[model samples]
Target chain A: MDAAARLFSERGYHGTSMQHLGQALGLQRGSLYAHIGSKEELLFDVVNQGAERFLGMARHAASSGEPAAARLRALLVGHVSTAAQHLEASTVFLNEWRYLSPVPRAQIQAKRDLYETVVRRIISDGVAAGEFDPGVNVAMAGRLVLSAGNWIYTWYHPDGALSASAIGAELFDLILNGLAKEGPA
Target chain B: MDAAARLFSERGYHGTSMQHLGQALGLQRGSLYAHIGSKEELLFDVVNQGAERFLGMARHAASSGEPAAARLRALLVGHVSTAAQHLEASTVFLNEWRYLSPVPRAQIQAKRDLYETVVRRIISDGVAAGEFDPGVNVAMAGRLVLSAGNWIYTWYHPDGALSASAIGAELFDLILNGLAKEGPA
Candidate 1:
């Protein structure tokens, strides 16, 4: 899965082929079928699994018994940390999912929509509970938080100056305080 | 340029060829070179011009005599508005620059670095003037702002619920208040 994700990220889904996968994995062309059925299936698996990881983290965080702000914080941490830890898969998930065939594409998008809804609900809840400003645009704010975390995969190197956790902490502070009411809740 | 950018965004850079551009433009293969050099030149033009538009907007806003918060607001408005107005070119600039040759790639990167530095300095200045929290990580905050604004192209639609300026105002409000010092500047 990691190898497939890395290749897909580097060369793109259409540019990579089963032969390249075989070369990378040291498998005979005929023997490769035993592990993976077809190139599309591999692409499906890589994309589906990648989406599942993100959606799973978001689902778990959204359902946690924490306050809306805490839930949002947890979601941010999960989002940035997962993207950093699974940088290749996150890249494939972000850019290469468009290559999936219709059925798998729909499935992945449904999962993505669910994850987005989870984020939206948290922000809306925050707004309702007065944890966030009442005038906040729930949908736009949700997308902003997700984009801010998602783009980290584009530039956050594991060995770079800041670890994923450090970045997450800074983002959490920035976001929560940003969303806070001017005076007090 | 729009056709080329849409094609590049739809098809990976390597997957797109001179023939694809000619077909998209309804030009004969031989006549294509009369208007554009090679496919690479087209890619460079698309990416560089898109980047230039962004950097120009940022530079203009950065050099304005506004306070840090107002300058940041101008930058966000410019960033999101430009991306929304030039969706196809923005898409290619965000994703297809890796396909450029080393020289063009470096030129683009240099411009990107300049943009990044401009944002960082604004945040750092805000911190120094006691407008934003002193402990804010200037570099990370800068990337967060860019990522949040840059990702606007992904979900922003011309006919969507909000206009580009509405979204920009909301983002500006979120970011400025989020970075504000505890009591007063």
Candidate 2:
């Protein structure tokens, strides 16, 4: 899966073939079929892997029993961590999503939307509970959160100065508090 | 420019050729080259043109006589509006940026960094002025704001129910005040 994902991401899904995967795994193109049913299956598996990881993280974070504000932070942090942890698979989930068959693609999109729905609900609850700004727009807020979390695959490097955790922490503060100057809490 | 930009963005950079641009414009490839140097030049020109628009908008917004919050609002709103006004060019800027030559790429990147740096400074000032959360991480705050702003291109539709102004306003509140319920202002 790793070899397939790396090649597919670098070369693009259409450009990758079974022979390439076989070479990466020290097998002939025909031999790969024994282990993996089809190219689309490989893509489906990789994408689902990442999607499951995200949904799992969201579920775990939701059950953490934190305040709504803290829960939202946990979701953001967990998401970036998952993206970093499964960089290859997550990259496929994010970038190669178009190559999936409609059934699988819609399934993945639904899960992605579900995660955002949870985030939106959290923000809405936070607002009602006075843990968030009253003016929060749930739709834009969810998309904004998803955007920051999703784009890390484009720029983050393992050896960069900021660890994923640190970056997530910084992002959490920025999103939760904003950059406005204010008196000390 | 819009026609060229649309082609460059919809088709991959290398996938787009002078011949195709000519076909779009109803000219021979040779005639297209007379007006344009090469495919790379076209890309660079489109990217530079879009960057200039964004840079102009940001500079104008930041340097305006409005209050800090209002200026930031205008900056964010103007960007979304400009991107919508020049959707094809903006999409090309976000997606096909890599095809630019070294010098042009660096220039655009520098301008991009400057825009981000300016936003960070504004956020820092806003935090300092007690109009925002003091604990905000200005750099990451800038990234969230910018990324959230740019992602509008991915999903926003001209005929969509939500206007650009509404998105900007909602996003500004999300980034500045957060989802936390407002205490007394």
Docking class of 2: acceptable
Q: For residue B118, give model 2's deviation from the true position in Å.
A: 2.0
Scored against the true structure, residue B8 in model 2 reaches a CA lDDT of: 72
Instruction: Residues A65-160, candidate 2: write the lDDT tens digits.
Output: 778878888888998888888887887788676568789889989998888878888878777787776656678888888889987886778998
iRMSD for each candidate structure, in the order shown: 5.2, 4.6
Range of the 10 consecutive residues with the lowest summed lDDT in candidate 2 chain A: A176-185
User: Best candidate, TM-score-wise?
Assistant: 1
lDDT of 2 by residue, B61-94 (tens): 8887666778888888888888888888998887
Best by DockQ: 2
DockQ of 1: 0.42
Model 1 misplaced regions, further than 4 Å: A28-30, A179-185, B179-185
